[model samples]
Target: MLERLIESLEAAPMVQRGDYHYFIHPITDGVPLLDPALLRDVACAMVTVMDLHGVDKIVTAEAMGIHIGTALSLMTDIPLNILRKRSYSLPGEIAVHQSTGYSTGQLYLNGIEKGDRVVVIDDVISTGGTLKAVLAALENAGAEIVDVCVVIQRGEPELGRAYTPLVTIDVDADGVRVIDTCR
Candidate 1:
């Protein structure tokens, strides 16, 4: 199953940005050119391997992570909480500083409270900075992070926590390559 997904991604349209290469796929970039079925297959594969039992909520960042998180929440019958880029002047809302490989900004947290057991899901893990900040915010909120999952991991940046990524991508002067897989 993972092999098919890998093949599909390998054949995806890639856009080079300076020294980085980005795969414009439905799962990651949500390129409308690709069929939605591809994203479903990737999400289903991730759900199959991840142990969501005992988790109280599914948490994810805004944008790309929303689709995967929604799917997981529906399948597991758990509530989904998304960290938004915009701030909401609401009670119990918390904000955290996030720095990723590509960009840095503030992420707001809501819909999750103390004592909640959550699994953080995302589309990609590159520098691990975003996940690190998110973990800190979740911990500060008194939420126990059960696990972390990423659909694609671009590089190793020491997240200080264990994470399961469907595929690990390595890019350099040689271009993108699937160096590792979680299947």
Candidate 2:
């Protein structure tokens, strides 16, 4: 179903950072030109599995997750809330600290209200740091998380709640190998 994403992942360049094999791809890195077809495919896959009914908003981290969330929002006609790296000092803004495998930063979340049903989407989930922070912030804001999903999964990192990943892969110096494809 996601042939293009599969092929692109396989062809992605892998860089070794210490013992980690980081694959640079459009979906996560925003390099090599993000194909619209791939984004659409991912959004389609998410809709098939994620329960969007009664969802009041679509939420995602800034930067990488924006495009993926945008595609999903556009397709679903749901409002999107982007968590930012910098705080705007907005009245209801909530700051969340996140530590990823490579970087650590505080993400600012705003606009989600109590009892609002939300669906969280991201480009990839490697260490689950960003998603974890996002989920925590959302829950703290009293938002009801309807579902969570990512376009790509690179080895599992424990996020408190279960999330659907369109594709699962194993990376090494050789390249990215597809371990599982959802959908």
Candidate 1 local accuracy as lDDT? 0.82
lDDT of 1 at 140: 90
- What would the per-residue lDDT of candidate 2 be over residues 1-183, giving only the tens digit for each residue? 689999999999988898888899999999989989988888888999999999999999999999988888899899999999899999989999999998999999999999999999998899999899999999999999999998899888899888999999998889999899886
Q: For model 2, which pairs clash?
A: none
What's the CA error at residue 176 for candidate 2, in Å? 0.1
Which candidate wins on lDDT?
A: 2
lDDT (tens digit, per residue) of candidate 1 on 1-183: 677667766766767887777667777777755455666766787777677779999999988899888887777788999999999968988898999778899999988889999999898888898889989999999999988889888877688878899899876554467888986
Number of backbone clashes in candidate 2? 0
Instruction: Name the TM-score of candidate 1.
Output: 0.92
- Over 4 Å off, model 2: none
Residue 83 shift from truth in candidate 2, angstroms? 0.2
The per-prediction CA RMSD against the true structure, in angstroms, equals 1.7, 0.9
